[model samples]
Target: MKKRLVVAITGASGAVYGVRMLQVLSQLDDWESHLVISSSGALTALHELTMRRPEIEALADVVHNVRDIGASIASGSFQCDGMVIAPCSMRTLAAVAHGLADNLITRAADVMLKERRRLVLLARETPLNLAHLRNMTAVTELGAIVAPPMPAFYNLPGTIDDIVNHTVGRTLDLFNVEHAGLLQRWQGLKKTAALVKESVSREHLISI
Candidate 1:
């Protein structure tokens, strides 16, 4: 059976993460993506990516309305492999931390927790307060990964797309999704140290 993943977009700053994840999933034949975008998420996408709801929904194999509490993904028997809330807002984080299944996005997250399925949240916020930190801790205790979209400088990303791709790629890594060439992998620093040592030896021989 094709692996199923639930992708939710909340009202966060980095909607591109969610959209990029859907784009990557769309290219994988062995994977199926179910998308749910909150109303505020839709607005944020428009503001950030200039993408309409239809345009974003097109990337998913199936799209569920945020208000649809009866969606298949909201049930533990849905047989989903995992769920990710890319660019998860602080509000959504609090809801999931407190087990508030008020909307379909949070509802499906609740299902993932109850079923012991993988749940990843790309929490997007800066200058986090105590409440945010405590909620993050709560979600962590509940088996939900609160992965904020922090950029890695080791990749030497040249453009915004590169940074975004690296973030999305790392998120896929958590789900064991195949995303080759999406970002540069870290090679050990031992090679660089060896090169430096060789250079120093050559310099010493020249001095002699």
Candidate 2:
């Protein structure tokens, strides 16, 4: 049986993370992806990625309507390995934190929490207020990982796509998804220095 993962794309600014995640996970033979996108997520996709609803939905093996509370994913018996809310908005975060099952996204998330399944929330926000902080803490207590998409400069990303890919790669890591050697994983300082020297040597040899 393949591992099942539920992916939710919220209204947060980084829709590309969820899009890229679906794109990659769809290709993995060992995993099946169940996708749910919020209404505001569709808007953000249009504004941030210029992606239409169908375009984004096509990336997943299974698409669930956000309003369909009776979806199979809403039940813990569906047997999913985990759930990830990429670019998780503060609104959705609060929803999941409070066990509010007003929508499929939050409902599925609530099921995961009650069932003790791994739930990763890539919460995207800045200058968080006390309410936001408390909400985050609330979710943490219930076993949800509040992961904000903080990019690492160590990769020396050269483009916007690079930064986005780096974050998407890390977010997938929380679900134990392999990158298929696409993204650069962080090696220790010794290995990094050696890699740098090897790259320099290769460049020097190329010039020679």
Candidate 3:
């Protein structure tokens, strides 16, 4: 059987993260992607990506209605490998933290928690308040990974795509998803420093 992953996109700022994730998952023949997009998520994607809902939905193998409480993913018996909420909005995070299960997105997340499956939340917010921090802490205590998509300077990304890909790649890593060539792996700093020194030395010789 193919490995199944539930990808939920909420009304977060970085809707592109979820889109990129689905795009990547579509490449893996052995993996199946089940997608759920909240109403706000669709609106956000339309605004940010300038893509219609159908275009975004086309990237996934399966799409579930946000209001469908009885979807396969909403139940623990559906047997999914894991779930990821890319660019997880604070509202969704709170819902998951509180075990709201008010909608299919939160309901599916609740199932993951109850089933002890991997649950990764790409929490997107900055200058967080106490409530946000508490909700993050609460979810962590419940066995969910709260991964914020902070950019890495070590990669020396030259473009926005590089930075976004790096974050997506890291999120995939939490699920042990194989996304080769998505992001540059960090070699040790000593090795990188030596390379930099070598380039600088060559520059000095040329200038002399």
lDDT (0 to 1) per candidate: 0.96, 0.91, 0.95
- TM-scores for all predictions: 0.94, 0.89, 0.93
Q: List model 3 lDDT by residue over 68-153, tens digit each.
A: 99999998989888999988999999999999999999999999999999999999999899999999999999999999989998
Model 3, residue pairs in steric clash: none
lDDT of 2 by residue, 1-208 (tens): 9999999999989998899889889889999999999999999999999999999999998999999999999998989899999979999999988889999999999999999999999999998999999999999999999888888888788888788888888778888887765468877699778999999999999999
Candidate 3, lDDT over the whole model = 0.95
Give the C-alpha miss distance for residue 107 in model 1, angstroms.
0.4
Model 1 global lDDT (CA atoms, 0 to 1): 0.96
lDDT (tens digit, per residue) of candidate 1 on 35-119: 9999999999999999999999999999999999999998998998899999899999999999999999999999999888999
Which predicted model would earn the best lDDT?
Answer: 1
Runs in model 2 lying further than 4 Å from the true structure: 191-208
Query: What is candidate 2's CA lDDT for residue 109?
Result: 97
* Cα-lDDT of candidate 2: 0.91
- The TM-score, computed over Cα atoms with residue i paired to residue i, of candidate 2 is 0.89
| Model 1 misplaced stretches (Cα beyond 4 Å) | 198-208
RMSD to true structure for each model, in Å: 1.6, 4.8, 2.6
lDDT of 3 at 30: 88
| Model 1 CA lDDT for position 199 | 100
**Predictions ranked by TM-score, top down?**
1, 3, 2
